[model samples]
Target: MFDPVSTPDVQALVYASFAQLRHCRYLLLRIQDPAAARRWLRQDAVMGLLKARGQLGRETAQDEALAVAFTHTGLLRLGLQEDADFPFPSAFREGMNQPDRARALADANVETWRWGDLPGEQRQDVHLLLAHFRRTPFDEQGPLSAPALQAGGLELVQSVPTCPAFIERNEDTKESRLFEPFGFRDGLTQPVLHSTAERSRRLQQRREIDREMADDSVVADGEFVLGLPNEYGDLSYAPDDARWPSAGASANAPPHFGSHGSYLVVRHIRQHVDRFEAFDAAHPPPREGAPSLTEQMVGRRKDGAPLVQQPMPPADLDGFRFRVNDAEGFQCPLGSHIRRANPRDTLGSDVRSGVANAKLHRLIRRGRVYAGECQQADHGACGHADGRRGCGKGLFFIALNADLDRQFEFVQQRWIAHPQFADLDNESDPLLGGRGEAAFSVQSPTAGTRTTGLPAFTELVGGGYFFLPGLAALRFLAETEPAPGPPAQ
Candidate 1:
């Protein structure tokens, strides 16, 4: 029903999780031979890759069944040097966008962050990243370790297959469900790109199928892709000094180099499954509690239902808002995991402007729970072998946005890690690291505040910030010169 002639095909707008892809392989490649890799990327591998970038419909088209994305370091390896020559955004030049890497480097968080806490991520020679959403089933040893990877001039430095937390199979119906490590349905709520006619039509199709969703908020495609209007009707670049200097109509054009690209953030979080299970077992609250202490901590029950004490009416993903029913944290706590991650209107005591305020900070979340069980959690993904004991069970959290510092980094540092979130004193996100007050508070119209302390459960294993360029820009990168290595040592 979508005419590509009139409406621009959003093949360039969305790539990875924009569609409902379940399996994704994060291929972190170290450009062994930048020139040869570029050649392969341009001539050999990137042929149908562009044609396969369209939006996903209900029936699931074979064209976009698999999506590919390259990283900033990947471009650097392709021989782009100097901030001026590069088309990356400003946050990437200074390396200030990846909050996980920035915070993980602290000695204070070393124990909590583990392998990712060190400074290795400071400069990830991890040149290229290919996110493959396999449609067919395969039996490869690893997703990235397949023969296709070796065909190029690059070396397979690390291959991480998308892993599901646990598997649920019903022989009777021949059906199964993939759960996140912490026991909630993942990829339930995601932002829809409403800026372009192409994205809008696809989102409509998505809504027709997915009834548990409703929202007319016109999120600019620029927010996700380069050269689009951001929240403030501007490119949403940082101030002049921090901005990526531009050269065009003006001597210092507003750095539109990142115009058609998206800022991609990938975090490899290692969730302590055993510790969480033990803590939940030990901290069992009263049975009368609607969601129990643990459920309230997560703002949802294990069944992916919201922690509302009483059921009202059917709704979509954005159907529920904090300020309306749970203004005073009566239904959901003010500092709960969901609330902290998305304060809605309960932030800073303002109840009316919650949705409006929260919209600006929103980033498209495309995270898949990665564990060892996804292979046979049901079947193989895109013909790749599954059940390989790869990275431990955790979250392959990926965020896409235009403004890295304002969106991704802001959420990581300000909300998730903030000690004083909302009016609550010395309280960080309970589900995250709440070094101050670990109590999970559930405010009530009658019982004032019900609080329970929970320890930090997730560890920042590894993460990095990269620029996902437009298809045209990607081709340009392919044609660029080879990266200049360190002076002869």
Candidate 2:
């Protein structure tokens, strides 16, 4: 048990980590009046503590305060945003207006484009729509306070429920498994922040300023909070600067342009564990003492080391000295899910740099393992007789950073989904790769392993991009109602 009184920093970090957990729910509110919405947010029943300023930004401060308050009140944290009033393309709006029978057909097109199947223009439009409503700010320095929630006029229209917390059991029952989407023990290797000492220690492990820069670049504290400067010395922004600028950048630059909140992308991906297990079972490899198909696919032993680098030992425990670069593929295969997700040490010369080019695109991952009996029993067989039908599994993949393209998208498209990774024979991420309907594979020569023809086993059921506005932005959003008509014209 943690005693916050004894260790406030640790307690705060822990609280922050819990807040980081993506289990927080979300809701859509359509307020007939902005004042009423403000009033609704300010209610004591809904309001929590106010976050300090200079945290992220005013917008993010509001978000953080709300999250903290909700968590304290035993209510799931919720992110709220307003709808964009734009002229939806004729074809797009028409699709939204389709009859029930035709809706599915139209939705298929939308989903395809959303998943990046259609042409550039169509995909761009879909991205715009999703991002417009979804993206949030990350002003780290802003206070996480809730003076606004008390002035309510908002009405809840829709909400997504939060996932239940897992209760650990002492028995060796199959129900005790705490695996990730790709089928390996997860939630164990997390960095623990029990106190300020631990956080300071972790910070110490970071690269020096000179080591982190591309060339003679000075690292700043703000860079740590926001992001590293680009070649132009400007703080990196997301989704291409030409595209999503800081709100109102076109008209006027804010006093703190780079100091604005970061961008966060959260995706609810559902993994098909049954299909993955079946694929592994059917495609068993032929080698002595070699990894099982499951181990090979995951690139790690149940203990969390690379299967090739470290032979599974009896005492090998989770969260123990799990180095990313134990060997090319000896301890942890180059393309393991976590390895791909975060190539910590294996970044090579690139690792010398500080957070800037280091791909230190760190975001607190707060997700839950939603495992239960198979919903579609007829579609597949059970992986284990424990009757634990593992499905509906995937990450609440969230990326937070000052810039989107430099941090989040770079990790997703370049590292995780990159087809040509160093010292590995793979075409895309084993767990979350594969274009459209095509299958993907990754081969590790260290273990003489080849995981091939893994079909796409997940889909984006429902997701939206949200902008966590700064406190000022929140006020701006609340104050400025949509204009009535085309101005003076």
Candidate 3:
């Protein structure tokens, strides 16, 4: 049974990606004045801006929703005292632009990023990220005007620009699904939080089954939220306030700061659609009966079906594993984007251990596309209508995890960016991997392995790591005074 009280503390975004709310805006902000920011945080209007898990399905504004997250700097600016004994992880504390971490993320040119500050670089410091969603397009006077942002003590550090959400509407069923800028289904395979309403809903709707199957989709709650058991059957580590008390220590110490909180990874990944299209057109399918170049790279068809043929139902597209179904990657390329992202049952010493180990590094992705046209009439492709050069469109990538090092970073460094993945050398992930001259090897049973030179398709523009705090922790930051200690430098 769900903990009615504690579960409510989780943010609504943790439960739902708000994909139905097509019109979305992401605001990157910097706190100018601590007192004014604290005052703004305490406001009833500001508090209501953030929604909780229990508040879902009952939201009065069915077309709109809002959520907020904070960087380590943002938390400090909000008067959160630095606790030496128990602190946030190094990745979250140091920020995402750390020179070493940036390299791991394949952000080769982070120095040229419009926003985000590197270590010792104080020019651009983004403290807060406020995201707003709506069904209808935002008018000329968008949700938050310049003056309104100023009034809230938030210096507008340029809106993280995003185009309208891409839609693929089925005329017969009147059902609409999301697509990325590259004209492929987005958010198909996501980690379902264990014992939540979403899991129950999926099971009830027959989207998934509740058996002792090999499906790695359903993961422990602690993988995405703190203070819960993870796939390893251990409670996730959280920042305990009791570890280091204030001068006048009392029995009533504040709750663990990270309890119910999750680490949020945000990346502004710009997709070069024109370049990708040009590349695809240039490289047609190597074999007569093989898939297209785009399909080879993405490891899925345009409608989001896996390349490998599985015996599962259409709703269970993610039910297949690499070792059991396509060990040789004949059906799906070994170095494909989805395979590298989640190499289910193929990375360890054996199939069973590999599947179990992969569970430890799972991430709950909540991303959306921005600024790309789609052709609903054509069931095959849905990209730029004009196919213009330098189309300013990409994905607003967002992922949540309780352990950053093990989940997001590991996938990025060890798999996506690792050129030697799956015993293949000189090739990273075809779609989201490192830029410059790269190669993709597609295994074939009859024909020899066809290797294709791949150009950089995606580039990381701006990104940062943030802490999506629980409602209780949000209130603590808003109302309580900083613990008596020297502020962190």
TM-score (all chains, Cα) for each model: 0.76, 0.55, 0.88
Model 3 lDDT at residue 157? 82
Q: Give the TM-score of candidate 2.
A: 0.55
- The models' CA-based lDDT, in order, is 0.55, 0.38, 0.74
Models ranked on lDDT: 3, 1, 2
Query: Candidate 3, residues 328-361: lDDT per residue as tens digits?
Result: 9898889889999999888788876887888898
Q: What is the lDDT of residue 12 in candidate 3?
A: 83
Off by over 4 Å in 2: 1-15, 19-24, 28-35, 49-65, 68-158, 165-183, 187-197, 201-260, 283-291, 303-327, 348-356, 369-393, 423-426, 436-447, 470-489
Per-residue alpha-carbon lDDT of model 2 for 50-110, expressed as tens digits? 2323332233223333432111001101222212332212222233213341232212333
Better of 1 and 3 by lDDT: 3
lDDT of 1: 0.55
Compare the candidates by TM-score and give the number of the best one: 3
As for TM-score, the candidate ahead, 1 or 2, is 1
Encode model 1's per-residue lDDT on 1-489: one tens digit a residue.
212222222334253342333445666766667667777677643545443234333324442333345454555556655344433455565453245446532214333332221134333445666776554333463323456456667777566676532334354673445467766655544555554354555456546543322342346556666555666676544222122334653453324444456777777777887788788787676656456666777777777677643224534334466665666776667777777776655543464455556667777776666655433543334113433223347887778877776777677667777766666777767766744566655666777654555656876656666666555445656765544466211
